[model samples]
Target: MYVVKSPLPDADLKTVADALQGALVDLVDLALVAKQVHWNVVGPRFRSVHLQLDEVVASARTHSDTVAERASALGVSPDGRAATVAASSGISSVPAGWVKDSDAVGALADALGTVITRMRQRIASTAEPDPVSQDIFIAVTADLEKHHWMFQAENA
Candidate 1:
């Protein structure tokens, strides 16, 4: 919308940007929440769960950067401010205080699953108007799905 001379129409770019921004916000939120779980998880599986949570946090941060960069490349400013992320992210609120390892795993898995579902929707939304943007979401989806599986495995 900001005078980007891309082959994709401004309208399409705007749509893709919106989807990317929303996902970016959620990814940022998820990353922080994952760190929260990592720092506070307790119980018999503490070490494994804590380490796995670090991996989740790392993945979320990396994916968020990719999504934000894509939005910027498309001429839309990526809204990653804490206020914007708090308001726009679709991830559920993380529990406060110490979290049980099993509970943390389940909660993180649920959050990843929610983002994965939204990513699939974003992918479909961009498919017709911007295949490149759709491809970006496609790659994101694969990574998120892999993470989701890894997180869920923690519960099993």
Candidate 2:
């Protein structure tokens, strides 16, 4: 039962909801992965990479909240549960042990790239159905891209 009704038509709402849910899962996973790496990263660049991972964690968390709220506004329940994220996230699983600083950088860059690619798809899918959601995806993609660039440069 949808206590909050959506203004969008049923078909459009479905499209937008799918995009929003996918985005939420990706963002949540991104935050978790970054935080895990932040805790385990080592090597000469450890200090810098650890700090950079925190930046990514912060951005992912902030964007995840925005995406979840947007979904709620549109009458879709956002599932940010760990199980849901693990099942639906587009990002690959993070390794389970201490990660070298360069490896951490590469891993984060790869994860960011994966999320950005999917965010672009969500942006397109929501464009006509819900421009507001599309705009959120666009903004999220831009921020993730910036982090991706920084991580890539860490190894350069």
Candidate 3:
């Protein structure tokens, strides 16, 4: 059943794999939430918020791909399925109906904050086990933080 083998020892591989899988789930759900908000956002700031939501979507999608690929390269299968994401994602759920522009901004900021917290934990967990994976987490966290800052500032 082992096709691609990992260079890491079993213990280290397990640690890195867990971190990567958690990261993948978070990123995938982040994109979905941002897009949902983008579609439903209203109010005077709708145009700007809608466009900003797209930026978060783009970042999440791009990072999700990188995280999945990194997991594969390390011989860990990445599960980005909707079910998996729904079950494992650290992000909170977006509301079901039309979201006011300010509410949308607040929601996204909260979700980004959650994801960034988890990403920092992953970054720490993977540091000694797999520096490469840790590096990816670091970069991802940086990008997510930028989005978080922007969303937070929207309400300021």
Candidate 4:
């Protein structure tokens, strides 16, 4: 689908909003998986990974909520439903029992990093329509990057 209603007279804002929506779906999926990992993780790193997964889930939920709000602020309907997010999310899902004990956390970390990179690119695409939205996207990207790095280190 097109990013905005019409053209918005500026391409940048729409791009930023699109980036936000994309990020929103990803965060929603990541957060849900984090929660699942937290609940189902077993084996050697059980306690540690479980706790870390809880933290990741919390952050993911917040980011998802923020991105949805950002999209709403820009007059775009946020695809906040779980089914919608799951169907459209760019991250590949790890089915139940398909996740390895060692890879659970790392996969989430990788997904976060990937989403952050894409969000930055979209933020650049929106340089003309709205600076405020661009800034918001940047902030979200930075946060996701930090989260990704933290997960990488934690999982290491």
Q: What are the Cα lDDT values of the candidates?
A: 0.87, 0.95, 0.96, 0.74
- TM-score of every model versus the real structure: 0.93, 0.98, 0.98, 0.81
Top model number, lDDT: 3
Q: Cα deviation of 27 in candidate 1 (Å)?
A: 0.9
Any idea what lDDT model 3 has? 0.96
Q: Compared to the true structure, candidate 2 yields what TM-score? A: 0.98
Question: Taking the tens digit of each residue's C-alpha lDDT, what string does model 3 give over 77-111?
Answer: 99999999999998989889999999999999999
Tell me the tens digit of each residue's lDDT in model 2 across 42-151.
Answer: 99988989999999999999999999999999889999999999999999988899999989999999999999999999988988989999999999999999999988
- Name the weakest run of 10 consecutive residues (lDDT summed) in model 1: 1-10
Distance from true location, Cα of 141 in model 3, Å: 0.5
Per-candidate clash tally: 0, 0, 0, 1
Q: Model 4, 1-156: lDDT tens per residue?
A: 544453355455556667777878878887887787677677787787778778777878887788788787667888879788878887766667645557877777777766777777767766667676677777777777777877788666
Kindly indicate the candidate among 1 and 4 with the higher TM-score.
Answer: 1
Worst 10 residues of 3 by lDDT: 1-10
